[model samples]
Target chain A: MAATTLRSVTTYDLKLAAPLALGFLVFFVTPLVILLALSFQADPQGSRYGLTQYVHFLADRFSLGVLGSTLWLGVKVTALTLLLGYPVAWLHQRAPGWGKGVIMLLVLLPLLTSVVVRTFAWVVILGRQGIINAALGGLGLIDAPLKLLYTDSGVVMALAQVQMPLMVLPLITALSRIDPNLADASSVLGAGHWRTFRKVTLPLSLPGIIAGCLLTYAAAITAFITQSLIGGGQMLFMPMYIYQQASTLQNWPFAAAISIIFLAAVLVVVSVFTVLGRLSRGYTNA
Target chain B: MLLTRRNLMQTALTLGAMHAFPGLTWAQARPLVFATFTGSWEEAHKAVLVPAFRKATGNADMVLDPMLSVDQIAKVTAAKNNPPIDVMLHDPGPALQAVAQGLVEPYPVEKSAYYKDLIPAAQEPTGPAPFFQVVGLTYNPETVKTPPTSWADLWKPEFKGRVGITNLNSTLGTGFMVELAKMHGGSESNIDPAFKAIEALRPSLAAVAANPGQLATLFQQGQIDISPGNFNAIQILKARGVPVEFVAPKEGAIAFKTTIHIVKNSPNKELAFKLIEAALSPEVQATLMEEPYLIVPTNTKVAMKGEIAKALAKDHAEIASKFVFQDWAKINEQRAAWIERFNREIRV
Candidate 1:
């Protein structure tokens, strides 16, 4: 009787899961398979198949430079988001009632706005005669307006703000999951508040930190709009380069090859970071 | 007449056939599909050209699909056997590429009544250009007391950190590059002199604006005193009382043509040709040259007066003598490599 019931339950689970599995096959797996095949094609129309595209990308110095810039941007954005998000998450975790709600709302506000709108706002704020320069000039900080737009720092600043929410939500969840009693017990044992936070709270929040970093890093690397708007086409990142190649130049084969390389590079970086994160967590726990 | 299952199935089948063959049901009506620019260009066409074309041809059914030029080309190329677009409006570069790729059919010169009236420079073997926009030096009159007379004046010491330039990815940038190449003894084949000249002007540049809007904003905000840009953008800003002036430099401005072409294998080729003809007609051209659309009419038959005359090229002679045209087909091949090189070497 028990075995029959178990078999029925298993069948029901499969029936429920079928739609999602089918969706993955159709939407995700199919496109990826097509991309992989196209990456090997010799021409834009895919009339012939060869490894020429991949070989060209590997040999091209411009392609390599773009790859380096993309990786660097991803790292910078990840670090900055973590630094800004961690404190906001900690404060929100400690806030009482209405305060918590307000912080949460503020954290989610940027996410509510369109990425394009947010990036444009940054353009307005960072331009030569923009708000920052105006204020600085008013205060007599300098005689000349500093160049901000069309620079790497401008791209990083916009991307960090755009990706802040992804980092904060995971962090807040991780911090909330830690028992308050652990902090109380540490305090009772005469540990200072700072020490208690450093030892207990920080270690407990490792999972969330790692999750947020990975998510933000991945997004930063693939970001197209922010880089395009802020970089002003002067700061060439991989995604922008790929877009130019495919659309303006109509070099689909080259674009596909670049995309494959970009995906591989992202995977390798994420894997290395994941292993490092695990090792750090283990050490902290011990 | 009876409410039987077989009768119901037959009725459903009949309805489905009607749905699928709506055009067939109405043999006299088939909508011509045209792919064109979005925003103001689309608005201008809908307001004037579409209705005028319909009235002239006695075909009231037409559909305008607004998309970016690249997207339009991609759609036509992807659906080569049966193109979704009957007519396509694009810049000269993409139009040449479309013709080269066999995505578009050449206009029938004999069929067009206004073809002879079109400015000789506007006449292309592939198609007739309906309008042209010139790119030259634009500056803030308030900051620039003495107007810049030449393109080389951008690098003058007084304009240091007060000039804005577009990156090489844009048409304006490409034009600037060509102008520089010409001024410094280099030509189309060799742009090395142009690169050196641009590198020298880097210190004077406030920013490399990616688009015209950004350049306009920079001018409005007094972030830039001078920049190389198109007359249309400068005119738009001047209309808004932005204290900007468009200057035709001594070395002539780059004239970029906006052209229309009939897509190959179009189901409505005749209607498409008619529409293109209507757009190029003196009546339609004159109306489009008015406010909100300020496009320079290519038809010599169209008369201009007042501010429009001052804003546009004086006549066919001026257009022939003052405007510089590039070999877009040849330039497009090396454009990507040139842009990458510009970003790496000159921008740095």
Candidate 2:
């Protein structure tokens, strides 16, 4: 009787998920399958199906360079966000109950606006005669405006700011889950603040760190608007590269092949993060 | 009425189906969807063309679904039998692509009252050109004291770190490159000189804008003093008090025929014809040629005035003499290669 009830409950739970499961199958999985098939076609006309598109992308040095730069850009943005986002998360944890709301609102403010609007603001801020240049110019610190916009570092900075909430929100959740007594226990045992953080707090927040990094990394790389607007035309990241090929050139086979390769590369990166997250979970519990 | 589970389920399912596919409720007689270009084009059409179209068809149910030419082609190609859009607007490149793909219906020349009245260049059998998108040199009047007279001024040492150009992804960018090639003894078939010229202009380039739209922003920010800009786009900026000026170079301003087409297999073919007819009519074209819109009218009967006449050509004969139209068919053949080379070579 117990076994039957248990089986019925499990089946009922799954049945409840039927609509969403069907939605995924019809909308998400089906298109992905079609995209996969489209990637194998030899030409835009799809007269012959073969490995030609993949070969073209893999053989070309420029294509590979674009892929590498995109991945590297994700890495830079993730690292920057983590470095910057950690303190805010820590502050939120330590903030007196009422103070937490203000910090949270400030962090969430950027996310409230459209990414296009945020990116254009960055464009204005980074331009030759922008606020930063004007400030620097007024101070008589420089003869000319710094070439801040349309460069690699500029893109990374803009993306980090744009994707900050993705990193911070996950981190806040993780940090809140951690007990405060652990830090106190470390301090009473004669560990310094830095040492306590490294040994106790850091290890405990590993899950949050990993989750935040994964979310931020994914968003930063796929941020087509921010990437193009900040990086400009000459930068040529993977998203823009795909857009140019697919939309402008109308070479769908090559575009699809590139997209598949990008997906695979992203999967590899994400898997590595997941493995770290799994290990961190084990470490935290132990 | 006692609500049984069976009847409740039946009602819910029916409602869900209706919500999911509104077409199921509306049946086959949907509005005529015309996919015009986004931004200023959409604004112009919404203000002028749509009203004209409505007046012609006695308040026909129509919609202006604005998007890029490439997007328009993609949507039509995706659903060839029952296309979502009835009409499409295109630049020179995508216009040829649409014709080659057999996505455009040949204009009913015998039926079109205004087709014969259009300038010779605007009269296309597959899709007639309703407007001309002119590309010329745009600069900030405050910074650049002397008005640039030729394309060569962009390459001058005086403009170092003050020039802007887009990559070959846009019609404006590709047309600019072809014109550069021509300046250096190359033509539509060969683009080598253009690459060499860009390489020479590398030092002067302040920003390689991702699109023509970005160039306007760069100008507002003072990131670039000058760029190869569209006439209509610059006019929009100037109206916004951006302190920018447009000039037709001695080499000639690059003109792209902005063609409108009837999508093949359209359900509302009759309405689509009426819309195109309204677009080509002198009255509609003349209104579009006025201030703010400043759209270059291709109808010979629509006398040029205001910004269009002052900035572009004064009359039809002057337009013929001044405007340099390229062989887009030839350009389209090697466009992919040019874009690839551009992606590889041009980096700021």
Candidate 3:
């Protein structure tokens, strides 16, 4: 009787999960399979299929530069967001009722706005005759307007702002779950505030930091519109390169090859973060 | 109470008649899907061409599916066997690719009444060129005391860090590259001179705009005093009270043709043809040329007079003498390599 009941429960659970499994198979798994297959195909109008696309991407110096720059941009944006977001998340956790609500709203406001609008706003703020330049000029701090738009710094700044909310929300969730007594115990045990934060609070927040970094880094690398608007196509990131190859040039096979490689790079980075998070958790428990 | 045998028979007859004559229902069932430019371009078509097409064909079921040219091409390519779009509009470069890929069929020129009236250059082997956009030097009159007479004027010492240029992804950018090549004793096959000239002028570039809208905004904000762009965009900016001017450089302007194509194996092939014919008609051409879009008409029958004519390339003589055309097929083949090189070397 016990065996039959267990079998029935397993079958029922499978039946309940069937829709989601089918959806994943049809939507996600199938397209990825197609993309992987397309990566090996020859360029348009070429005869037969081979590894020509991948070979070309590997051989080209421009492709390698774009990939390296993309990874660098991802890292810079992720680091900037963490530096700015951690404090805001911590403050939100310690604030009083209404104050906490207001801070939370402020943190979420940017995410609620359209990315294109935010990017354009950054363009206005960062242009040669933009507000910063105007202000500096008015005060006689500088004679010449600064060249801010269409530069690597411009792209990084815009990306960090866009990806900050992603980092803050995750950190807030993790930080709120920590017990206040742990910090009190550390303080009573002769540790300074900074030391307590660095040893106790920081280690406990590792999972959230890892999650936030992974999300922000992946989003920064794959971002197209913000880079296109601010970088002005001069800063050719991998996503822009992929778009140019696919849409403007109509070279789908090469684009597919680049996309597959990008996917692999993202997966490797995410796996490393996950392992680091696990190690940090083990150390904290010990 | 009315369910007598005679009443029931009368109701049955009415239902049979409704099925027999499905004129209204049939027309409503299949709307002709046209994929074309978005924003003001789509608005212009809806205002003029859609009504004209409906009047000519007596078919009121036509839908305008606005999309970017690249997105339109992708959609048609994906659904080649049963294309979602009945008609497609694109620039000459992508239109040639579409023809080569067998995604579109040639326009039936013999069937179009306005075919004879179209300028010789407007008719293509694969599609009909309905309009032309002239790309040249656009400048702010307030800042640029002397109007630029040639493309080389942008590299003057006084204009350092004041000039803007579009990115290589756009047609205007490609045209500017070809113009530079011609000015420096090179052709499409030999673009080294062009690259050298652009690199020399790199220090003068204030920004490289990603799209026409961004380019216009830069001009409006006075961030750039000079740049290479289309006449239509300059005209629109001028109308909005921006003191900008478009000049035909001594080296000549590049004329890019906009092509209208009928997607292959479309369900509404006949309606699509009629729509293309209507777009080429003199009335619709004049409307497109007048305001908002400011497209130069390809139909010779439409006589653009006054300020609008002065702003555009007028007549065959002006077009032949002052406008340069590129082999789109060859340009398309080399575009990716040139853009990659530009991004790595010049734009850096």
Kindly report which residue stretches of model 2 are placed more than 4 angstroms away from their true locations once superposed: A1-12, B1-28
Docking class of 3: medium
Per residue, candidate 1 scores C-alpha lDDT tens digits across B1-348 of 569999999989987887788675654235798887876678889988999888988865798999877778889988998898889988766777788889988899987899989988788757788888789899888888999989989989999888888877566788688789989998766788999998899889777776666788777667688999888778778878999998888888888888888889887888888899998999998998888777778899987644556744666677778778877776777777777678678663
**How many clashing residue pairs, candidate 1?**
0
Clashes in model 1: which pairs? none
lDDT of candidate model 1 versus the reference: 0.84
Docking class of 1: medium
Candidate 1 Cα misplacement greater than 4 A, ranges: A1-3, A6-12, A43-48, A276-286, B1-15, B27-30
TM-score-based ranking: 2, 3, 1
DockQ of all predictions against the true structure, Cα-based: 0.51, 0.83, 0.56
> Model 3: per-residue lDDT, tens digit, B1-348?
758999899989876765677563455335899987887678888988999999998865899999988888899988888889999998877887888889888888778898788887888857788888789899988889999998999999999989898777888898788779878998877778999998999899888787667798788767789999888778878988998999988887889898899999897888999999998999899888876778888888888754556855666567767778887777777888888788778664
Q: Least accurate stretch of 10 residues (summed lDDT) in model 2 chain B?
A: B21-30
- Of the candidates shown, which would achieve the greatest TM-score relative to the real structure? 2
Q: Candidate 1 i-RMS (Å)? A: 2.2
lDDT string for model 3 (A133-221, tens) is 88999999999988788889989999999989999999999898889999999999999999999999999998889989999999999
C-alpha lDDT score of every prediction, in listed order? 0.84, 0.94, 0.86
